[model samples]
Target: MKVASFLEDVKFNSNKPSVLMLMDTDFSKELRVVFKKGQIMEDHQAPFAIVVQVIKGAIDFGANEELIQLNDGDLVSLKPHIVHNLSAAEDSVVRLTLSKADSLQRVKNV
Candidate 1:
């Protein structure tokens, strides 16, 4: 068995969003992403489907040619290779779930 906490040791970056691996399960990798207000993760694509959950604060999620405002406790899913981006409407913490086939480096690059 394994354990992790997204709320522990939380830190935010001034220049960009911060990504930290919370845990890796048999079929997926979970990440804790912290974004400072006004920070943005430019358009990026994943090779596998992804689930994004807003754990704290708010985010302006850009996808499907529109911007969706997501607040605390909100969750979203996107299909593989879909262009998406995120902007922090406030200091926020997001939970990102990636398929086991995905690469952590790709997320860190964004």
Candidate 2:
């Protein structure tokens, strides 16, 4: 069994969001994405589906040409090839779930 905490040793960056791989499960890769206010992960598309959950603070989730406000405890999912992006409404910590087939480098490149 693997154990991890998204909130543990949390850190943020001024120039970009901090991304960390929390664990690699049987079917998915769990990640912790920390964003300071106004930071953004610009529009990008995932080759596989993904799930994103707001663990703390607020975010503006841009997808489907819509800006969705996600507060604490909010979650969103996107299908493969869907273009999306994230903007922090405040200092935020997000939990991201990616398909096992997704590359960690692809996320880091964004």
The local distance difference test score of each candidate is 0.94, 0.95
Which pairs of residues have clashing backbones in candidate 2?
none
Q: Cα RMSDs of all predictions?
A: 0.7, 0.6
Q: Tens-digit lDDT track for model 1 on 1-110? A: 99887778899887889999888899999999999999999999999999999999999999989999999999999999999999999999999999998988899999
Candidate 2 lDDT, 42-96, residue by residue in tens = 9999999999999999999999999999999999999999999999999999999
Maximum-lDDT candidate:
2
TM-score per candidate: 0.97, 0.97
Q: Lowest-scoring 10 consecutive residues by lDDT in candidate 1?
A: 5-14
Candidate No. with top TM-score? 2
Angstrom error of the Cα, residue 102, model 2: value is 0.3
**Candidate 2 TM-score versus the reference:** 0.97
